[model samples]
Target: MNGPDILASLRANLAQQVQHYISPIPAPLDVSPWLAMALLQKAIRRGHHPFALQAAATLLQLSPDKLWRRAVSIAFEDIGIADLEIVSLVTASLAGKAFRAKIGGEWLVASYLVERMCLAPKCRSADDLLMLSERHPAYEHLRLGLTYGTIPELLALVRSNAPLPKRALALWYAVGSDRCPSPQLRTRKGAPQTVFDDLCEAGHPHTLVEVAREGFRRSGQVLCPFVVLLASQKSEQPAFIEDDDFPPETMCGSLPSWALDVYSREGQQALRRFLGRNCDTARWVRSHVPPVQRIKFLGDILFAVEGGLLRNHYRWPLADELRRSWAIECQGPFCPDAGEIMSMLRIDIQLLNEERQHV
Candidate 1:
């Protein structure tokens, strides 16, 4: 065939190939090696340029593996930062599909040309450069000398400089707001159980503050133990003096003003009415107050006392006298039906004693 006829035939074949292979979403650019090679071969047959034909041939000669690697690179470099989801989806899809092995030599070259033409070039700025450096310090030296002018240049730089894991991390951070500082920190293996021990031991304000700051740094979330410890430290109230000899009503009245705020109005009224009606009639009180109700009330009172004692280990001076009267009236051998109430009160006493040991 004559040179002009061969050139015309090559152009017609390339146009057919383009229609068959390339998807028509983004406008196809001249960056495609397959397209460039076809055009270059046609021009060379027409005696146009030897250097251009050699360049296209060299690009066409790239192995499938190298071309697929370039495609993966373009996925991240071109689609990353601006629309990082595309990078993730493309990378995952490529990995899952095993595109390099599936496409084979010539087809792989054609696929690269199509992909390169279809996707937009991504650009990275000084901010992205700094962030990349922070994310992967290993690449700091390589990134130092390069100055990127376009999206394609930035993508090329990333492909050359960043490792697969670093590329994945950068893509993850770019795609989602829930980026973790390090994978180890996010995983269970990186967290230490001793941090919880420290929080539990954080009895004072200073220690709790330190635990909170350290916990936040170690894990993105706050540790519950430190929060509890801090709350306990901050809510500590002043000690109240208890009068053992005073009536239950009088003792309740003598409670600190701040202590009154702890209970709801209804609870305060119920407690006050119970104390007022039962202060002198111990026998009647035991009969009216059911064993279960007495036990529940005692449990609540014991919890309050333990919390109060932790804040300030003050003796309720009235506690001994009240206990003496309660023991006599509720546990006395002469009192009939005292057995059940006494049994419930004894259980409360045991719980109270246990709480004291912990304090």
Candidate 2:
């Protein structure tokens, strides 16, 4: 099937009158769990509530647990610091089937929370800071050295007037290096509750700490701490504003570019074809990357330069710095040629994205 057009358009259009985000994209619903999940988060970030709702509903049908998991992550990951009340709402919604059943029923509660998150202002600095802390060359010394600090020492450092990145390291060690959400750091012993408790004891708000604690309990994302820490900064007041870069986007048959994420079936095929090209990005990866890992490595680079973020980003001083660090530091990690490869992919990927139109 190329894509569902006529019937889906009618069903989706009819859905628009009763509820706003209930209307899905006028495309096929035979989407994978990965694609549905991706569309959910990206749609929320882009403020495309219709697709967000559709994706959430799809997950509710195919994988109820993933629907809850992704919603919780998006809450802490996307809407961090912009609206704590919304974060707490999303966190509470994840309690369990019993809680959701008591609140209203599963769909009513899930759909309402999903729509609320879609409309909420977003801040991704926490996630950006995670990437920077993990892979940025500037943080290598901090990562290695802090890996050796005692829990008390690290906790003390976390509350001191240190730079944000150092605080990130101290916080990481204090919590335990074992919570490797990306599978990067490993083998350190510490309890996550201790980190949250110390943050509260060190003068952070109890409510915010509770939000992060619950989020961390549910998602196991290191980003949870980063969210509270980034918000608790007393160094300066950073101005927040909206920014839409309007990156190249178009429809492939009926599905929007937002649905054409790296994990989608069609997207995987496109990347495979792009890799056969003689472009600098493809050439460097072919020669530098191991034969078994080429696709994974190249896909990471593509995700970095391409639609890995909102076409519209919530911008602020510290968040923008973290974003820049992500652009420079996170390209597939462990590859010396990632800088040159990312530069090439930024240009070459457009040609590939254009080809997606006719495919």
Candidate 3:
């Protein structure tokens, strides 16, 4: 038959083959559900495949439905853009009533759940981004047209021989911010590449472009790179510690005047919406979302941002500690105190946003 049908047949055959091994399921734990789930997450993060499976099995003994839902949440929040397709795989596996009801459908699903969790690539960038986005003081200023109104003037100045780094951030901001009315990004290999990618390829750092693509793929949201650039400009300390961490700001010395002309033509409403989300809606979306699908959007964003900050800021100092604790390369960058970095980035962006308002 077709590919999916064949795959289904294979899964069915494999499930049957393992049927004898599925009995004597683990006893339901007397532990708190949150605690049990946390323990399972810890195992998964540590790449302890056996322990992760055992935890999933334990949770399944209590409630298959809960296990299934939690698995999806982890796929989004933990795995995230590091492997965006994992969420789709999780959904396809747990999509229907029949699939959920399948070993006559119980424990096989647990096997599927654990296998998926263990195999998925983990990244916490989205989580960190969400957390930072929440408390960023600039959110209010940006929403009120304080930051939105400056685009034309800023674009004009960048085109008029302002530093290359400034030009690059300006061009990237227009394209990456979703404020562009009719964005026509270039494509490479049929996937959309950012307008600033050419500048990136020419030796300028493209962290913003990479961030925008990864964040969008994972959460369907466009990150405002301009916010980051503005934040960096205001901070006396460099946005990145290492010069090579991202492309040098001066890589593109002068942007074409026409590059950002398109944004000037868009109506105020679209810009307002984007600004509102940055300033207002985003603040509560994370904490207020229902548990089942919260990680899908809000959670993914927070984890990814958190992961990014930890990687950029604390990765070196904690390397030895991380090596001891985590077997995977991905684990080296995690920091429990990532909120501090987020606050720093947010405050810089906020200060710049505030400055723009007063000027």
Relative to the true structure, candidate 1 reaches a TM of 0.21
Please give the CA lDDT of all the candidate structures: 0.31, 0.72, 0.39
Query: Per-residue CA lDDT of candidate 2, range 1-359, in tens?
Result: 11123223322332332244342333325677887888888888887877788888888888989999999889888888877767877776666787566545567767777777877878887877887788777777887788788888988998888888788878877777776443555458677878888888887777678778877888887778888898875236656557555356677664566466567777766777777887887788888878777777777776566655663465678887777768766654457445677778777766667656544
Worst 10 contiguous positions by lDDT, candidate 2: 1-10
Candidate 1 clash pair list: 122-151, 123-151, 242-318, 243-318, 244-317, 244-318
Candidate 1 per-residue lDDT, tens place, 1-359, comes to 43234333433443344444532222222233543333332222122233223323344454333333443343332222322333333333233234323433344334434343233223211112223333333443433332222333323332333543233333222222132343322221122233333333433233333333332332333221223221342233332422222111111231211122113342334333343332333234446656445433433332222211211112222222322233333322334334444444333433223222221
| Predicted structure with the largest TM-score when compared to the true one | 2
Q: Which digits, one per residue and each the tens of the lDDT, describe model 3 over residues 246-293? A: 111111111111111112222122222223344433344333444344
lDDT of 2 at 107: 77
Better of 2 and 3 by TM-score: 2
Worst 10 residues of 1 by lDDT: 243-252
Q: Give the TM-score of candidate 2.
A: 0.83
What's every prediction's RMSD, in angstroms? 34.0, 8.8, 18.8
**Model 1, total clashes:** 6
In each prediction, how many residue pairs overlap at the backbone (N, C-alpha, C within less than 3 A)?
A: 6, 0, 29
Tell me the deviation in Å of residue 348 in model 2: 3.6
Judged by lDDT, which candidate is best? 2
